[model samples]
Target: MTFEFTADDQLYQLAIVLVAGIIGGELVSRVHLPKVTGWICTGILLRGLEPYHASFSGLTTSAVSSFAPYMSFVLGYIAFTVGAALHFASLRNSGKRLGFLLVGEALVTPIVVMAVMYFIGGWLKPDEMTLRTSLILAAIGIAAAPGTTVLVVQETRARGILTRTLVAAVALIDMVAVGVFVFATAYLTGLGDASADWHEHWQHALVSVAIEFGAAFLVGTAAALIALGLTRTIVGPAFLGPTMVAVILGAWGAAVGFGYSGILACTFAGIMVSNIRHDTVRATGAYLHSIGGVLFAAFYTFAGMKLDFSLVLEAAALVGLYFLSRFVGKYVGAFAAMSLADVPTRVRNTLGLALLPHGGVAVGLILLVQENVHLQDIADTVTTVGLAALAINQLLGPSGTRFALTQAGEKGKDLPRLLDFLDEQHISVDVTGKNKEEVVRCLAAQLYATASRPSLPQEEFIQRVFEREQAASTCLSQGLMVPHAILDEGEAMTGILGISSEGLDLPTPDGRPVHAVLLLATPDTDRKRHLEVLAAFARTITRDLNLREQLYHARSAAHAYDVLHAEESEEFNYFIEDALTRAGAFSENKT
Candidate 1:
């Protein structure tokens, strides 16, 4: 059973976990469960099999620790995307109910858990560390893994108010958890030392907390600017990919190096990028998301492998108590707050269920607590209980989230997006024209030649675009124009992308020559869909200067199509499709 953990063995175990995770995920998905559940279960199974293969089963806690850096990157990426969801425009009018719901769940979950654990923990453990453990656990209680919740949402194809709210809520609560944990741990650092002055310690803890958050915020903001500058300057994905990864990892590393919350810093960076340049966030996010499956699979599987069920047996009472108390606190707090906020009855009832998964953030917090010098005395007990409870939470959390989305009638509604209409055939590179009218006519002819001809004559399609253009210039600032029209008879939406690096002589409000012209034709019956498509295109192209630059410089129609269909741009597509569906824009499709 004794084996020297070598680098080779780590690689071997990594390969096994990845393959096993994919297989496990596939199996669980067949049985109608979240793939994350399967991945975690597979990790636990691998851990259980460790003694059977001493060298290969290096999936023990030590082996899992070796992958900590990789996991940090994955969590950072997830946090960044979650942060991007915190756009101010969306949250500004989300209403006081969302605010109250957030406060209710956030404040109530920890208070209730802390109260329950403090009193019950004293009765069960009867130790000096009981209060500290309760406080620490309660602090950790607020974090729900945005990564897991978002995966479930993505897996279920859920979109709507409930999904958006839940994702944002989980992300916000996690940041709150980080802040609370930092302060609580700081205050408790030397609290039990007889020689330490409690008053001075409290004062120092306050200063430490402020510095921790303030420095993290600065690190994140600086990271955001770096990302913006790179994307704005770096034109191609070949160089952009590595640069983005470096920026994200470097930001996380810097925060951690400074003894701050790396996750929070990444989250803040994402928020800044999302609000400042949504196109950049979406494009980068889509690229990251392309590889998210493997990263998440490895992460959750590693998480499962690190669990020691022996601790569960030893702290069965405490573990059971923590699990029940935390769940009750989350549900009651969410339901109560939503009710008070006058939220819809279904949301008020089920939103709490969606918040049940406390994955990476909670696990990270407990690990931090274990490593703290002041918290060392109770580390063993806390780890035993905390990990056990986390195992239970991770196992149930995804299912809870899936159930909530299903009940909310928001599942499987994210398909048939606006981007679905555009293909290589619909794109033309180096499109030339003497004026805006000539460009519109050429784009319309190309659209007809490549795709199905609409019931309306091709000339009329050109006329409609001209008519709409006359009403108000579709020219979005920064060399982009979206000339769209509603076709009287068309089964679905179709479009063409004309890349004119030389610039079209379109009369733009900003007076910039249009370098990219997006011609959109929507079925008259689905007029609202046209508006949504126009908005999506305008937002995406205008906000992402990198994408615009690449598209303009594209060498061929296929190249332009690739630039448009690149994975980095898919996040914005998903967001628009989901948001539009929720708004009833796509409820009544033309065909």
Candidate 2:
């Protein structure tokens, strides 16, 4: 049956696209592949829906564009999170190394790509070749897909120096991309105008550059400051997510409306909030973390759909040259930079590969080219080559990132697991209580007494725990309760686990009495770590029946600890040995 695709049919198409993307991601992940590749692959399949039904011919195109608002939001969200990683204290020690590496890669990559493209075009396709095309293409080449790189890093749970440096570098490189593109466009415009004075043209170009960046910075900073004020004063829990989302969207919209970059503005806002609100960083991240998955799935699936295979064949030579030159340029530049900085061998080798993914930013730049009056002559050629290169990069980039992080021994170190802070000394037996408040007080007193050199005094710690419980019930389903507090100072996460034979009368979703209570204390700065540790505990108890039963019926503190760390529970513990070593090595090199 011939079907005419229209706006009304988009919701149905969206449902199908999301499901296909999920299934594709699941299947790919099962085979030890990047789930992102699966989503993209499914998107590519969805793009060819015409084969299934002739009426579906324009469905993917219209549906994808119709969801533009969502795509922009997700990109901004991803950029914000990536920017959050740039904590001042964390980057201070290795700032020199990062600076050297960024300058090397950012400066060298474009030069190599432009030179190669220029020479290759002259030899192979002189009629289509121009310095303007080469310059514009190289300007677009500077950005590695922050979304893809961040997704892979998060997916593998990689941490340590390489991961941090790669994330920070990607964020900075995109900014470099914006600057380089602006100047190239400005100068090219001046070059196109034969009667324009060089001195006057330079002044105008500088003004344009300053305004483009200045407006974005002002918008982002203003948005962050406003959000910070509201979040600090607003005591309601429900207000956090919406408040932050609205502020980010405002920054994005304001920047875009001013004829600048929304992504850059979002990045600036994230950096502002991250550096300024160290204590509330976790709360800020939690909102994004909660909604990130579905949004990412939708964004990536649409990314895959945008890949037109027809363009690859149409400009085979240009695509081949563009992809190869860009790859070689990034790798070589990164290696040279790392060598000069005397970084770890593993990181030096793998860092470039980690930065290979290309997406949204480059596509935006190419679109800019298409819209420019003077650059219109070669816009189609640039777009075709640029997009085809991006398509190839997306397919190969995630795997490269996973491999790079793995080789650097930085996988699975992003967050602490539950067992990392639990041991025999901290797990208590015969935890006694009559009611929920009593139970919380009992756990708090026990944990504080047992803690070795705690930052907070015994009474203060107990009071903090009580205040947390007062704010929100720590009770969970399956007769478990987790009470946590953020301290002003802490070297690491410290906590106590209590097992009660006689259940305490606590509020729970399942209306069961509390048999187990895990009290946690982390420094205010380590909020994300606090959340992840809580997640680990919930996941363990909810998934393992035998382990939970063993912990409840344990004979002593030792037995309880054993139950928590048994062979079955090993999967829940995420700390790996070499991750620490790599982190130390990274520091040693910096020193």
Candidate 3:
């Protein structure tokens, strides 16, 4: 028996691509590399195999080429999601320093890259070097891979000023890159036509640019409105995924039909939706996240399939130059920008490193150059150098981003264990209280008595804890309650762990009697530390049912403390050390 396949069978091709991508992603994730890198690598491997085996002939290449339209939709969706990071409310809270840093990096990166590339272009390819080509290279170099940055941020569960600033800056960088590319393309067109009237050419270029931007904005706005309306009327949660897909497709089709940027259009739509119809955006976000994984895998896999090994080899010198120049430019520009903005030392030092990923947006810009008839003379050179540099950046970018996040101390760490924050005086085995207020008050009294100087009034402290409980119950599932409040003049965090043998009548969501109650009092100025303590407690007790039971059955406070200490992780120790240092309670012996 003989089996055969035809190029027209796109479903078969898609299945093969998705399966390969899934396997590759899993493999790379195991090694701590970005899943996107793995998907791209899989595509490249499949492409490489085409020449050796007749069975593999044209499948990878043909599938990628045929899937071009769908890829555009995926790109638009990615851009839109990225745009949501630019929520105005979030931006306002980020302050003017963040804005300055973003502008500084966006402007400096391209200029630095352009200057370096201009000087090196002569040696790399003197015959092809031209002012127009150099300008194009610089414009394309402005884009950084938001997808990779987002993936790393999500994987690490990073949260802090640095993470917020990095995300916002990435959104702004791509927007600025698109604007720069448009203007550069116009200038390049005028350069190619010296005989044409300068004023007329410029006027036409300006008009064309305006039309593209206007059309894109209009398309985005329309799509957003439709999606928002659908979300309001749609009852089933399952429809949300299809609704987002439809909106992305519509925006992409309109942008393509009108000779506009699908990315810009979808991004604008996302921004509008996020800001104006926030509920709709939030509802769709979960659905999009689930579906987006497979789409991104397929999109990147196809991107890898298009990689030209021969072009990469031919343009090796130019590619290396581009990589080095862009890398230096991003770091220097981010550092200088942050310094000028007077950003925190951690942000200034790490933001540049985090922004190293460069590919998706740059690839889109280069594709524009390749498809433009007016730039045909320099298209081959641009594509070869651009793709080669992009390949290198994609391979190395995620690691750089992860390193920066880790070093900045924003990546999720094991917080100080609940027991680590308490001592013999602060732990009570028999916490007797009839209600939530009495239980919380009892814990707070224990913490106050243990303090070196109990300057804070007992009544006032109890009142604040009640205020926090009123705002939101801290009761968690698995019989745990972590109530926390800020101390007015506290120098450090004080914790009290109380285990109740008989369940308290605390109104927990699960309605299970609370077996363990951990109360924390943190310095009013240190909101981050307070959250860290609560998070640590929630993570520990909720995940381990047996541990909760062990605490409930402990004969004494010391035994309960031992149970938690035994579960201490390296991350938790680091968190405790850092917290203690901030609280002025750390000593050399603790290490």
Candidate 4:
């Protein structure tokens, strides 16, 4: 259906999705699986079955389905973001040892899986198909879920040679798999008579990929320029959002609406925006991760809508066989690929387990080939890939990725770079607990050579802050907080952010939940430095809501510290100063 929407519907849908996806994504994702997985599950539970899955049906599904088209648009954009960023340098810098592991697993895993698929196909339908279909199906079956892989890695907060290289290999090869499928699909559609025409489709598709990639980059560049020029009171999130909409809606309209390849266009936009050295683009990305919550939620819900339960039962054999084939194929293929490249056994086993989760591309490819007249088997294969993928990938994907990182001894890794820097400098910052304490600690740390531990416990701090601020009114209301103590000499004008997923009891100046706590305290003498830091931090925090949101959910002290230091590094003081300061302090008791 056309997405020509009314103003109220637009507003309503937007509100629903944001509430469902962003706010809900955090809570449910932790309880269930990946954030994306949780979003889709939430969507389906709310939207898929009628009579509302109970009384609160409106709360769950009603909004999800209404915005399905926009969800498609957003997924097309996000999927591109997740898929498009493959580079040789990124992979290389990530590590050679990990690269060896991924390649090794990918190689060996496929061979084993394909052999099994061939046996299964031979047993089930020998006369109906040729050996080639079995082989192709077997190979296709081996395809790993790149999106799931990506989601899992992102969720684990892991970054390293192994993670980066694995993603690169998947992105690099999936297109080749698609090319092979197009050929196989063309042959299958000829009803056992394969044609060279399949080769032609790849040429067309690739040429399109090239042109679209280029054009989309230009489009994104122009878009970023326009965004950079904007200093109008637009919240930073609002700025990147409109820009993203322009990219997805303007160019993608021609593709998805016209039944052309919007996927390539979306991928191009995300790449150009992400790769460009511009603050607005980064601002836009931060906005995207936070603001597009609803669109993502709706997109997943609609994906659930596509599942045909009646058909699923009847085609159970194809379903079971396809998934079984895929599982075997991917596990072995990924392991072999990693092994041949001389990867470590520890990494190899992790990579093998890590490789099985699948999502976005498999679904897109399935959609691309679903309508062919002579491609019944191919259609069956597509269903096997998409549905089976949804099933298996969703279940083990996030957990497996988390397991991989933990096994590698990389738990609680930080995505924000600023926190790590502050850590090395020994900047004592309180990141655990409620927001106000963090804020107090941050400011307190900045002022003195000697660091003081946070005296207030999280709950007590939350209670006190709530007495002053009120419940759910996050200190992040204006995007920054500067709480100057009534006293002048005790703590050097402290500057720190309190943070928590379980929001503080502090009443917000604004009704939104508070996540980051920025405490600003200073002596009357250091007025200049206090105001200077305040102005800089406040301007940045106010502009980027997503930053506040991300910080609010940070699980570690390092991550919370990084949130502020990234934009304003000069303001943080996280260490013990020279020896004289401590020695001189003895005068207080001696006097």
Identify the superior model by TM-score, candidate 1 or candidate 4: 1
Deviation (Å) of 467 in candidate 3 = 12
lDDT tens readout by residue for model 2, 477-588: 9988988777885457788888886777777999887888988888878887788777877887888888878878776564565455444565666554544666799999
The C-alpha stretches of model 4 lying farther than 4 A from their native spots are 1-32, 43-48, 51-68, 83-90, 94-114, 125-151, 166-170, 186-241, 254-260, 273-281, 308-312, 340-345, 377-381, 384-386, 415-591
lDDT of each: 0.78, 0.79, 0.75, 0.50
Q: Local error of candidate 4 at 490, Å?
A: 29
**Which segments of candidate 1 are over 4 A away from where they belong?**
1-9, 56-58, 190-202, 234-241, 417-591
Give one digit per residue, the lDDT tens place, for model 3 in 1-591.
Answer: 997776557876877788888899899999987788898888788788876642643475655778878788777777777887777644533546567766765678788878777777765678775666777888888887777788778877775557778887787788778887887788668767778887867776777677777888899989988887877786456776668667788888888788788888988888878777555566667877777677878887887888765566887888888888888888888888777765556778888888888867898899899889999988987888888988888778878888898887667733443334564446777887988888988877777655322357878878888898899888888788888777776466677788887878778888798988888778878777677666766766777566667778775554554455442433342455566676575455566
Give the TM-score of each candidate. Answer: 0.70, 0.71, 0.69, 0.55
lDDT of 1 by residue, 1-591 (tens): 896656457677777789999999999999999999999998888888887765545456666788889889988988888888887644533445567766875589889888888898779878733778888888888888898999999999986556767887877888778877887887887576668798877887778778877898899999888877877786565555555566579779999998888988988888888777766665676677777888888888988888776677888888888888888888998888767755445667788899899888888888887788878887787788888988888888899999998887668855665575665456777577888788888888777764244667898888888898889878788888888888765467788888887788777778888888888888878887677677777787778878878878776554464455444766555545466676585566643
Task: Tell how far residue 360 is off in model 4, in angstroms.
Answer: 2.2
By lDDT, the better pick of 2 and 4 is 2
Range of the 10 consecutive residues with the lowest summed lDDT in candidate 1: 89-98
Pairs with steric clashes in candidate 2: none
Q: Write the per-residue lDDT of candidate 4 for residues 495-582, one digit (tens) a residue.
A: 3444447654545677655454555434567676655555655655676567756555654443454454443332332112322355
| Candidate 2 ranges beyond 4 A from true positions | 1-7, 51-58, 235-238, 415-591
lDDT, model 3, position 417:
38
TM-score of 1: 0.70
Weakest 10 consecutive residues, lDDT, candidate 4? 418-427
